[model samples]
Target: MIHSLDPAPSAQAAMLDGATPLTQLGVIRVEGEDAAAFLHGQLTQDFSLLGLSEARLAAFCSAKGRMLASFVGFKRAHDDILLVCNRDLLAPTLKRLSMFVLRAKARLSDASENFQVFGLAGGGVPAALPTAVWSQWRDGQVSVVRLPAAPGAVRALWVAPVGAAAPTATALAEPLWQWLEVQSGVAMLSQPVVESFVPQMLNYESVGGVNFKKGCYPGQEVVARSQFRGTLKRRAYVVHAEGALVAGQDVFSEGDPDQPCGTVVEVAPHPVQGFDAIVSLQTSAAAAGGLRAGSVSGPHLTLLPLPYSLLEDI
Candidate 1:
C-alpha cells in the first residue's frame, strides 16, 4: 500500500491549495506526422496508444538500460506531443533525442520559452481539473494533468502559453511545492542522478513510468532481464534525515562502512520538520541497522514509508 505523507494536518494541507509557477521544469515539443511513431520506437511507453486525455510517465534509457531522463508526456493533437522534464536536463536530453531522429518526419525543439507551467492544489482548483493520476484535459489555452497526491490532498499540473494568466485562487511559494513533490515520493529527473539507475531502481516501473510490453527501445533487454530474472537489488525508498541532503550523494549502512548502500535521488526540506528524500538503495541494506547520508559518519537517516509497494516477487 502507498503511505500518506506527514501525519500533521497542516503540512498535508499545503498542497496545490494555491498556484505556483514550476520554473524548474522545461518542456520539449515534437511535432509533424511521425511524432507518435518516432517516440514509440525511442522511449519505454507505447506512444501509439496514447490518448489526448491521458499523460504517461516514461523513461529514456541508454543502451545498457540506465535511465537518461524521465518525462511526463502527453499529446496535444495527433501530430503534436509535449514532454515535460527538469530544466537542467532538457538541453542535453533534447540533443541526444534529436540524434535518433535520422530521417523521421518529426521535429523536436525546446518549448520552455514558449510555455508556462504551474502547480495547482487545494479545493480552490478549477472544478474541471482532471482527478485521476496522469489523466489530462485541455482547453483552447490551458492544459491540466492530475498528479499523484496523498489521500484528501488534491494536486494538478497547469500548462499554458508563457503570457497566459495564473490558474489558481492564489500563489504558493516554490519551496512549498517542491517539498510537496518530495512527500509525494515521485522524484523528477535532474543532472546529478542522470544515468545512475535502471528504471526499477527508482520505482519508475511501479509508478507507470515503464512499459514492458512495448517493443524494444534502447535498453529493452536489460530492463526486461531485471524484471523477469529478479536481478533488481536496489529500489527507491523515502527517508528522513536531520541535515541538508544532496542528490547523487552516497548512503552508507552502519554494518558495512566499506561499501555505500545507496544514492540520494531527490530531496527537499520537510514542510513540518527536518528534511525528507527519495533514495535508491540495496533492499538488503535498507533492513540493516543504522543508515547515514553522504559518508560513513554522515548525518543519520531514518527510513520513512514509501507511498507505493515494490513488486518484490517479480
Candidate 2:
C-alpha cells in the first residue's frame, strides 16, 4: 500500500551535527599526464575538462549500459585524480579500468590504504568548506568535497592522508552516515548491484553524473538512445517500509505480480523507525502503487519525496 509518513523530527536534529569515518568507501588514484583524458574516455562524465576545484559524480558502465561502479571523482593536481567509490568494488573496478589504459600515460592503483575518508554533516562540516555541491576545497594535504545536503543538514566528504587529525565533532555512527547517504537521494554503486542498472535508471544525468556531449565511452550509444528516444521506462525513487531492505532485492507491485517491478538500489535503517531505500522502479508500476519489498507478499513500501528535482528528459 502506498502512503505518506511525517518526517522524523529527531532524525533531522540528529543530522544537524556529527562526523563519521566512511570505512565502506575506498580510493582509486589515477596519476600521470593523461589521467583526466583517459578517464574522460572511459567514464560517464567529462573528466578531461574536470577542474581542480570541482568533483563529479560519475559512473563506469558495461557496453550494455549497466553501471559497474559509481564515483565521486576529482582532480587533486593537474596530473593526479582520485576516484572515491565503494571499497568492495575498488580492486575489480581498478582492474577493468586499467585494461584500456594501453598507452594513455595514466596509472591506476588502489590507494585506499593511503587515505582516510569521512562523512561530515551540518556543524561537523568545516565552516570554511565550499557550500556548493560538487565544489572542492583543499587545505594542505586534506580535501573536502561539498556533497548534496540532506534535509535540514549540510554535508561534505573529508579525505586526508592517513596520519591527518580526524574531524573533531561528536562521533557519528557509520549507520547514521549510511542513513544520511540514503536521505541525500544519491545512490552509490556497490558490489551486490553491479551491472544491475544504467546510469539514467538512477537519475545520474539529472545529478551531474553524466555528460551527454562527451565523446564515446563504453555504453555511450545506449545511454544516449535512452535519453533521446524517450525509451527509459524505469527511474529511481526514494521509498520507506517497516522492515529490513537489502540492496539488489526485488520489488513487486500488485499490478504485475508475475515479475519484479523494481530493484532495491540502496537501503538504510531509518533513525526513527523502519527503513528508507532508493529503488529503481518501472514508471508504470511506480504510478500504480502497491509496492512490496523482497517478495510479492513482502512488507509494503511507501514512496517518499526525492530530495532533488529530476532534470526534464531531453
Q: After superposition, how far is residue 261 of candidate 1 from its true place, in Å?
A: 0.7
lDDT of 2 by residue, 1-314 (tens): 12234355665666557899999999999999999999999999999888988999999999999999999998889999999999999999999999999999999999999999999987888888877889998888888999988776788999998999998889887887887788788999999899999898999988889999999999999999988897679999999999999999999998789999999999999766899899999989998999999887898998887888888744
- TM-score of every candidate relative to the true structure: 0.94, 0.96
lDDT of each: 0.84, 0.89
**Model 1, stretches more than 4 Å misplaced?**
1-7, 10-16, 312-314
Cα RMSD for candidate 1? Answer: 2.3
How many residue pairs clash (N, CA or C atoms closer than 3 angstroms) in each of the candidate models, in the order given?
5, 0
Report the Cα lDDT for residue 125, model 1: 56
> Which pairs of residues collide in candidate 1?
2-307, 3-307, 16-121, 16-122, 17-121
lDDT of 1 by residue, 180-243 (tens): 6776777777899999998999888887888888998999998989889956788888888888
Per-residue error (Å), model 2, residue 208: 0.7
